[model samples]
Target: MSYIPPHKRQLKDPVSPSPFPDSLATKVMKNTDFKSSSVKVNIAYSRDAIFKWFLIGSKGISDEVPPSIKLVPVSSDSSDSRYGEKSFVLMNTNVEKENVIAEESEEEERTRWMLIAEKVEKDLVVAYEQAKKGMQDHHLSDNAKLRLVARFGKILFRRIHAGPVTEYWQAKSSNRTFCTDVPTSFIQNIKSKAIPSHEFCIDLEKEVYVVQISHYTRPHSTIICKCTVKEDGSLSMYKAELNPLRHLVVDVSCIDKNLDMRFMLAGKRKMFTLTEKERSNIQRMLDSVTVDSTVKGGLTWPHGKPPSENGYTIFEVCHVRATTYKNKTLRLRVRETNGYSERFGTWEVERGVTLILQDINTKLQEQNIERGCVLEMLRDALGTIWDFLHCDASLT
Candidate 1:
């Protein structure tokens, strides 16, 4: 073999045939063609598979979008148009559903509030009716009435303590005394000044002098006297009589600020005395009275003209034994009308008295009497021994 330099070795052409045996070369060409065809078939199959997969993925994306969004066509001019339409439809659908649900909830809430309001109104009406009924049926209790009787006694004591002034003049001489030393002018004046009555002065032309007298303690009783007045100015009594409707008798005494009063209603045949319990109750009520500057003696009814619905006045002082009291002793026997027609039960009197006390205490809470000063004064004036007789004069 001829030796050649390494840099001068000849390069073979790419298109030249192989320098191998024909049979081996043919086998090589066959293997090369088979490999080339296999590669081309694989590439064509991969491209078609990828295109089908892309189409399927696109269809899946369209299915995921809501039908309302899918109906909106994609605009070629604006890339964001399709996305904007889809979002608007989705948002609108969600918002509409939320609005409907909210409206239903709001309607339910309004109905609930109305029901609550109606219930409250009904309760208020019922409560108001009950309160009205209670007020209408209200009445005083037995204890209250007893207190009222005590209050009445205290009022009488007050009047007696203040010196009960009488309205009529008592006859100093005999019941049928005659005036013989009367002047003719005096006779004429007396006849003119005197009120003529059918019973006393039947003939006014006659020179007659008549005097009618009524006592405060015995208002229903009258003393009438008729006298013949001569022109010579002499008055002579011709007739005299006592007209009485009913008799009144009373006995009262005071000792150390305590009153022992007894009364006898002759016409009614009822005799009663103030028990120790009654006196103590009266004292308590008197002490509870408040002092009022507008009233005389700092003690008076806080509410004027106490309610008489119960058929009796609480603090009414009708008769006072003023003239009978002498040297701390009083005795009285007179005729008067029976003002109290109906009999009072113990309960009624107590209820009335309690009501009066409540009214006074409600307005002012202050003690009026100190150590029974007013009562003591009354006791000192009325004396330890007293007697009174009177008719039923309870103001109904």
Candidate 2:
């Protein structure tokens, strides 16, 4: 009768099998309206095992890997570097000016940050230790939640945290990592597709849609995945198929207090909802200044009022634009936008949209498009995203 089972039986180690009346597999059949009862009993305990074995403190959890991996949302913490690395450059500039007064060259200060990679390595080593504590302690592997944490770890591991590890982990790009032991049999039916890096983590509270398409190597064909988190804590996968002929386009938007901003196509995922404080900070950002989508997708946008005089204001911070595909493998992109399509004051955004439209149509005219080749492209995108942002830790 109770949604949760009695705690007495499961209290042995707080992670032992619960004396529940209905197993998760049984409940899943009942809840999903499936007719089969011949399901795994471990489903009921998979979430628990993940929590106890991989998510809590390291004191009372097993270090061994569990059968099921949970995906928990690692919400952005109250703490994040405000200015990112750009702030350091500005500080160095000021310091260099003072150093010049005292007798140091600007080049010296510029080169000073080159060593930051070494320090970041120290931080990464420390972070990995701290990150594993939650997993080693709790064993919570839902796969439908806590994805951000896993990816945060990846970004740290591959990029900012320590620069780059030895080729034992990866080669060439900071976005790639090679795992030698994974067997294809365990992950059968998995195929490659392309998806957009835009609108990543969209509607995190309700869904996790990504775009996908069949894989193509020559940079003409790309695909993406679109996944949603179901009410039962399961994931529904989707994909975005690229029209190599259709020319997938991406546009990043942000403002510059310094006016000198640069961002590579580092990586992206579907945009999810933020915590209360993040929402607040985002609101403040919307109020204070104007942020523009550098890519001319020709978006009409509505600007919000500044918090300088008025109270807090709400704003639309996400958007989507998936391409129509002839294949089942989809090319999806969930772009995070600050109401670019609605914020245009008097400037016409159609011009920008036309540009992208032209690119797609132009490619089509060039006869450079193909279909049903998403496996490799999708694999690469998945690999890129997974290596850069995914970890078995999403099983939180």
TM-score of model number 2? 0.21
- In terms of lDDT, the best-performing candidate is 2
Q: What is the alpha-carbon lDDT of model 1 when measured against the actual structure?
A: 0.21
lDDT (Cα, tens digit) per residue for candidate 2, span 318-396? 2233322222222222222122212222111110000011122222222223322322332333333322221121221
Native-vs-model 2 lDDT?
Answer: 0.22
Q: Which residue ranges in model 2 land beyond 4 Å of their true spot?
A: 1-111, 141-317, 320-336, 339-396
Task: Give the CA lDDT, 0 to 100, for residue 48 in model 2.
Answer: 16
The model with the greatest TM-score is: 2
| TM-scores of the candidates in the order shown | 0.14, 0.21
Candidate 2: worst-modelled 10 consecutive residues by lDDT:
252-261
Tens digit per residue, CA lDDT, model 1, 168-282: 0011110100011112232232223321210123211222333332334433333343444334433343553343111111222111111112221111111023345633433
Against the unseen true structure, what C-alpha lDDT does each candidate score? 0.21, 0.22
Quick one: how many clashes does candidate 2 have?
A: 100
